[model samples]
Target: HEAPSPEEHLQARTSPLRIEPPFCQQTDDFAHNSTLHGISHIFPYERGWIKRCLWVVFFLGSLTFLLFVCVDRIHFYLEYQHVTQLDEISTPAMVFPAVTFCNLNSFRFSRVTRNDLYHAGELLALLNQRYEIRDIHLVEDNVLEALKIKADFHNFKPRPFNMREFYDRTGHDIKDMLLACHFRGTECRPEDFQVVFTRYGKCYTFNAGNEGHTPLITTKGGMGNGLELMLDIQQDEYLPVWGETDETSFEAGIKVQIHSQEEPSFIDQLGFGVAPGFQTFVSCQEQRLIYLPPPWGDCKVTPMDSEFFESYGISACRIDCETRYLVENCNCRMVHMPGDAPYCTPELYKECADPALDFLVERDNDFCVCEMPCNMTRYSKELSFVKIPSKASAKYLAKKYNKSEQYIAENILVLDIFFEALNYETIEQKKAYEVAGLLGDIGGHMGLFIGASILTILELFDYIYEVIFPFSHVVYIGRNHYSKERGQYFTSLRKNCLLICSHIYQMLAL
Candidate 1:
């Protein structure tokens, strides 16, 4: 419709029309190309653009910032959780105390060491003599743990063992045909267990042992003198608790170790997961293997010959001053006949002296003579092998003797077991089947590397987000925020950066 004059249109429209601003700018003729008010002219436009840009950037930045904050907070929560989780089973520090640990090597009963036993090959050969076998396989394990015996001396090896060699790797041949069969397990992979020998912790080349959590002497006092808790025939169901992480609950932690006579788990592959074997040695022995108990009851003893002593991990060992049946002096001595044998006359003088008889005497003196560690079954026997007292008995003793319950429980009870073990009148010593302990390979670097790689990547992602997205500033348009308290903030930032770097490094490693 054609509008009237400007004055008439103004008069007709009573409802004041909303006026839209002009899209283009206007200027006077005097305003030259070098306009002085151009900035002023663009000021309003810039304000509008600035506001819109600010809204968009700040909105996106706030969202991203919120998401990042949530992520970081969650990360910290999880990190603390994981740290706490790990705290339960924190890597077991060297808990094997220097207390003269009762080495199985010295036990009069299981007194067989690396030198005392036949090789797996010999045993296999014996089996060959009995049965027709296609290929006789012998897995070897050393009895006289060269390592455990010399643990006190050095942690250095001038020449490292080639872990892949045949002769060096073969351990002492344990002659338990039954254990060998069981070790074969369900997996009949001949290649997997080719005379392979596994060792636990640092204890290696130990004396062969039979059954249950083999006892060792240590300083850790539990329930009583740590020795007694382990000896009694009475076994308790020790609740395995998480001993590693700081978590109060032991759901997944290394269990609290306790002494018991027979909790198959304790002596089996796993149990009170406190002690674990470290390096594994697979050995095959061919020659004669004979180990005599040292003058001292301790299985791991200093060798007389420095060279031979050094080979079994004993260094700087002098001849024990208390050695009565000195093997070094009686070399090539033959076993005396029945009449020629030294009579069992308990006298101060050396009544009888021969290799075989002295071997028995020396070991008896080293360990306990009257209280032998062998089979103590008969009632009339002097050494009973039943000293381990029941908890009720110990408790009764504790109440009666007015002693500490733990003292009664552990120390006295263990003494009781020892007392019982020694009661047999004639303890017959024989070679029994040995079940060996093998250390775990779980916590090593090579195993954790794969899993750690993934965690490192996630850590890196967090860092890169912080760096690229800029934790402080919301946008490049204008500096809206600044992270102060430089030390902590930067440290966190650095850690994130480092984590990311490590992740990248892992990828490279991969």
Candidate 2:
């Protein structure tokens, strides 16, 4: 070949080459070798124009459909749908729930000291005035006069009352109230019960397990397998002067609550009433629940931070919230409220704490952000009662207690609490669309619609990085290093393109 002149050489260098770019060759090779179906047909070398058009149309349509389905699935996953399922599990033994019982009449009239009676009557009168019960006048004027207090309902200021001392002295003794107690065919003593102050003034709880005591467990299921109590409601000790006007508080019976040891007793809200002259049988079923935390659920994974409680629960949270509200507004806490704050005097209770609690219930219930616990145990009960003290047993029991048959029949009751079965129900909240399930669904759809898999996706990404990255890097380097003239830029680009083609050709040869 003849050596070319400088002008000819420069023209040849700037001329646009007919050869396809190196990236175009790489793309063609990828299409032919890709595991993805229908790609090779779209890039066929010798196919007619009509066939090529059809293949392009079909591939793009299917690809668009696949993309739409994938997006829909992804949207569904992002919504974080959940499902709840119930399963029953048999257990060798179940922890016995805390059993708390309170007298309908908080104080025994005969047991009330003169000082306690005086203070209690004042407290009751204030409560009645606060609730607008219209029965405050029933409090003896002599007693009010003895305390040197006027009967003005609105301006009532109570004497300093020691609520815990008064309630403990006047409340029915557990030793006297529990005529008989048995657990699992063994006799239980009054010492086994712990004193728990509640809305009912002073109540007794069995198996509370809150003071580092070991929890009680029951292996057998059925009536009489757990706790059985013969209790005296002390009807004669219920005085009209100490009556409460609250609707639920007026009934003549004992209020009983079944709860987890971790939770405090909320007797007024959660207790069941068992009237005298009836043998009450409570059949309990334990339910254990597990819930997922966000984004699947709003359940809390850690115990809520609180000032009064060591464990977190809805009831505990509400109690803490109420204590905070009361202390913030009234500078004191209620007797049943858990806190180290000074107990609300009867006057403060009637004027400020009571109204604050009512407001909390009526309007500010959502003020406390009590999230559901991720794991919780709950007890559900079914109650059945049979008339106690039959004609034959009434006289026999009356002789044994030296009381009238009528008194025996009216004042005594039997309570039986036992598990319905040793099996517990588990209710779990689970993510219906987990990440793994979503990825599996995506893979299935890809394989079904586009004949692609994880491997195919990886191959495509590899092809892009290998081809486009080097090509882009070369163009960036040429632009930065070459002359500003358009022809010089084209000449640099042509040289880089040739270099890429030579490398690709050597790769193919290998």
Q: What C-alpha lDDT, on a 0 to 100 scale, does residue 483 get in candidate 1?
A: 33
Q: lDDT at 465 for candidate 2?
A: 87
TM-scores, all models, native as reference: 0.16, 0.85
- Score candidate 2 by lDDT: 0.79
Candidate topping TM-score = 2
Backbone clashes in candidate 2 total 0
Candidate 2 lDDT over 52-121, as tens digits, reads 8898898888889889999999999999989999999999999999999999887665664444434444
Cα lDDT tens digits, model 1, 175-234, are: 310011112112112221213121110111121222332333323222222112121111
Compared with the true structure, model 2 gives a TM-score of 0.85
Model 1 ranges off by over 4 Å:
1-49, 71-81, 85-263, 266-510
